[model samples]
Target: MKIRNIFKGILIGVPIGVTLIDSLGYVARVDGISMQPALNPDQDQTDYVLLNKWAVKSYQVQRGDIIALISPKDPSLNIIKRIVGVQGDIIETIGYKNHIVRIPEGHCWVEGDHTGHSMDSNNFGPVSLGLITAKATCIVWPPSRWQFLSSSLPESRLPLNLSPPTLLYSA
Candidate 1:
């Protein structure tokens, strides 16, 4: 009878745990060298991060946020990249790279911090917002490196056209 009770607990616990993770967030290991100094800084070790699923549920994201998304070239693969351009923004890509490309509605341009080494918007074009899986909130593993990830974009990487800030009018 005790064994049966233990089995019952396992059955009930598993689904609840899965539901929480699916609705909330989960820890994921960073892979590859594409993110460089920000992520996998040392080739010998890796960083594990908390990927927040709730942040992506609304299909909204800001530039410079590191996000995990389904690979545009390969459906089976998921990749992490920084949002460089949002919908309606035009980016002037590095070194002769320009296509009359304005990020399409519901899409964003993503690229790795390492550049040249990443498989990102530069290779496959902007990714659909639907493909975004999560936003990385912090590094969870490797005790030496634990901190919240903040949104940041390099000035050189800023979009060519940004909506002008609203001006205040005094009555």
Candidate 2:
């Protein structure tokens, strides 16, 4: 009876836990130097962030939001990046196919903070919002480095036609 109850408990508990993690959030280790200072600042240490699947479940994303998505270039891989331009925003690319691009509907431009080192939208163009799995909300590992990740896009990377932070503040 004792063994049966334990087995039953495990069966019931496993699915519930999986469902919560799938819908709520999950911890992912930051790999590579792509995100650089904002993420794995020290190559010797990897930062683990809480990726919130529920937050972007509606596909509402904005500039500066760090997101995890299925790699457009290679479906087998998942990549983490920052949202630089949302649908309808015009952006200047670093060295993408087009010098400037208008983010297409249902897609958004993403880039790594380390620029040249990242394989992001800068390399493959805007990614479909459908590909986004989650929004990175904070660092959860390496206690000394733990903190809520704040949304912040580099000034130079801001969308050209959209109001920049400076303009928004000045007006």
Candidate 3:
């Protein structure tokens, strides 16, 4: 009787845990040097981050936000990058085939903070919004490094063409 009850508890607990992770968020380990000073600063240690899926469920993202997405070239791989351009914004490319590019509708350009070391929009061009899975809200591990990830792009990396601000008139 106890064995049967244990099995039932396991069945109920597993699905609930999976659902929470799928819909809410989960902890993930930063795995490469592409992000450099921002993430994985040390080659020997990795940082764990809380990836908030709920925050990006509507596909709303802004410049400088760190996000994880499915790799455009390889559907099975997930890549983390910082948003550099949103829809309709123009960007000056690094080693990309084109020297300049305008983000297309429903797509955004992403890059690593480490520049040349990353395989991001520079390699695959703009990525569709659907590819985004989660936003990295904060670094949760390595006690000394715990902190929120801020959304701020380097001045030099800002988009060259941003939409002009609208002026309002009141009577």
Candidate 4:
């Protein structure tokens, strides 16, 4: 009787734990130097961040947000990048074939802070919004590095066209 109850608990508890992680958020390790100073500032020590899946459930993302997504080139791989342009915004490419690109509906331009050393939208073009998995909200590991990630884009990386203000008249 005791063994049977233990087995039952495992089955019930495992699913609930998985559901919470899937719907809420989980910690993920930063692997490469692509994210650079914002992520793995030191080459020797890696950072672990909390990826909030629930925050992006609606597919709404802002420019400068660091997000994780399935690699367009390799479906099996996941990559983290900063959103450079959202739908309808124009982006000037670094080394991409096209000098300028306009993010199409349901697509966003992503790039790594490390630039030349990273593989990102410059190599794959804009990625579909559906590919985005989660937003990195904060660093959870290394107590000294604990802090919320800020959503701020480099002035030079701002999109050519921003969405018009909804309020026509300001006070």
Off by over 4 Å in 4: 162-171
lDDT of 1 by residue, 48-81 (tens): 9999999999988999999999999999998999
Q: What's the ranking of the predictions by TM-score, best on top?
A: 2, 3, 4, 1
Worst 10 residues of 4 by lDDT: 159-168
The alpha-carbon deviation from the true structure for residue 168 of candidate 4, after best TM-score superposition, in angstroms, is: 29
Evaluation by TM-score, superior candidate among 1 and 4: 4
111 Cα displacement, candidate 3 (Å): 0.2
Q: Which lDDT tens digits does candidate 4 get at residues 2-49? A: 999999999999999999999998999989999998999988888999
Writing each residue's lDDT as its tens digit, candidate 3 over 1-171 gives: 999999999999999999999999999998999998899898888999999999899999999999999999999999899999999999989989999999999999999999899999999899999999999999999988999999989977888875444468767
Note the residue pairs that clash in candidate 4: none
RMSD of 2: 3.7
Question: lDDT scores for all predictions?
Answer: 0.90, 0.93, 0.93, 0.92
RMSD, each candidate, Å? 5.4, 3.7, 5.6, 5.5
In model 4, the Cα lDDT at residue 116 comes to: 90
Q: How many pairs in model 4 have backbone atoms within 3 A of each other, for residues 3 or more apart or on separate chains, i.e. clashes?
A: 0
Candidate 3 off by > 4 Å = 163-171
* TM-score of candidate 3 against the unseen true structure: 0.92
| Tens-digit lDDT track of model 2 for 27-52 | 99989999999999987999999999
